[model samples]
Target: MMAFEFPGQYYEVIRGTLRDVHAETAYLADWLAKSGKATGGRVLDLGCGTGTTLRALAARGHGGVGVDASAAFIAWATEAGGDGLEYVRADLADLDVAEFATEEPFDLVVCLFATLNMVPPEALVPLLRQVRGRLAPGGHLVLDAAHLLGFVDTYQPSMIAHHQRDGVLLTRMVHTSVNGHTACWRNEETILARDPDGAVSMHENGFDQWVLTAPQIRGALAAAGFRVVAEHGGFRDAPPPPFGKGPLVQVAALDG
Candidate 1:
């Protein structure tokens, strides 16, 4: 495994780090609580790592189900589950979560923080469409992806953007190539802390992530039968070039 991939060592460090999951917490709790009038339904957190969002939703008095692909993360989430939360290790690229869909489709489906970038461009359409099918009428779809214009300097893209609490050091490297349909990013990470004290310390150990452009993300969602609702620059109607450290966030609604 390369430094720019989800390496095993990085996972162990992540399990120890990632203390405060406020980002997802804020998104889920706020969105589910005051997403306009009354929808009266639970929420689904896709690619939910450690079931943070799921637990957050539960805290907000809503039933939440978190889904991820990493078994380790899933197990951690499951242990963290219960008390009105459920975490499943299912491939979101191809999932049949009819049971949690409640035979009425989920009221909200979320894919936050460029979770879509991990998947290939080809799989996006089908994935979104499938998710759309599991959404109830008048439900909302909020998916996020990487922002293009946000990072033009590939060589010196960004420094070791550290997730201090998570003991993570993230380094990004953009591919020296681009196209209208596809774009890629290379993320190099390092884990710098561990349990049992000085026994296993890391000067460099972490995972990687590939990002996508705004257009590519939008096109995929539109093709999946979603109506462009409101895509803010950043978290809350920020500004252009809404990616990078800004965490390019997009919130859309699947139309029936």
Candidate 2:
């Protein structure tokens, strides 16, 4: 179990600018509809940082429970409470779906933004099995992970980004190291934040992630009793090669 920790306050401040939440949510909705799934379904969001995506889903009539290992993220998300939304702080490896079964089984389980890469390769099958046990009859799981090529192309040796919003300035410096032989990578990140009152803060964290291939992911899903239904290149319609230079997005359903 790798610890994927981030500065929650800084993350929340810059998340909206990091990606297009509306577009991502729309893409998810479209994917679900294309798979013949219904709207207004319950969702379980694994590695839901700051609950941005879950909040967007709720606005479109879906209810969701967001789980993250970072207490800061959970706290920030909980503070921004919305209808049909709940936040829980728990590591994915130690998750117990039974605790969230009060309503009904989840219609969809999402592990986005390469969150699954944080899970140790050996634990993936068991985690998938756990997710399978908590899904509705027609439930589906959608996830995105960094493939070998993507990792190589996207994660440079070092990079820096600066963002300023709402009287707060955030600077993130990232250093990435790739171990091709092991298909693993480590990211060391340092964050510098300047608040409205001119107070400065610095935070540092690092985590390791595995670069999985399409076949590897499919095999893991199959081992967990799931049948791969769709594979895409970074949320697009076209499928990426097994070792392409983009995020591998997959959708799987229980193999009955």
Candidate lDDT scores, in order, read 0.60, 0.81
Off by over 4 Å in 2: 1-7, 34-38, 101-103, 179-182, 241-243
Instruction: Please write out the lDDT profile of model 2 over residues 1-256, one tens digit for every residue.
Output: 2343555667877776767778778877775565456477788899999898888888877888999988878988899887889988887877777776475678888998888988878889999999999877767899887776677667689999898878889898989888878777888888889999999998887788888877898999999999988887766677866545656679999999
Instruction: State, as a TM-score between 0 and 1, how close model 1 is to the true structure.
Output: 0.73
Per-residue lDDT of candidate 1, residues 150-189 (tens digit): 4454335445433333434433222233333445555444
Look at candidate 1 and tell me the lDDT of residue 1.
26
How high is each candidate's TM-score? 0.73, 0.89
Off by over 4 Å in 1: 1-24, 34-40, 98-104, 151-163, 166-182, 188-190, 201-211, 237-247
Judged by lDDT against the true structure, how good is candidate 2? 0.81
lDDT of 1: 0.60
On a 0 to 1 TM-score scale, where does candidate 2 land against the true structure? Answer: 0.89
What C-alpha root-mean-square deviation, in Å, does candidate 2 show against the real structure? 2.5
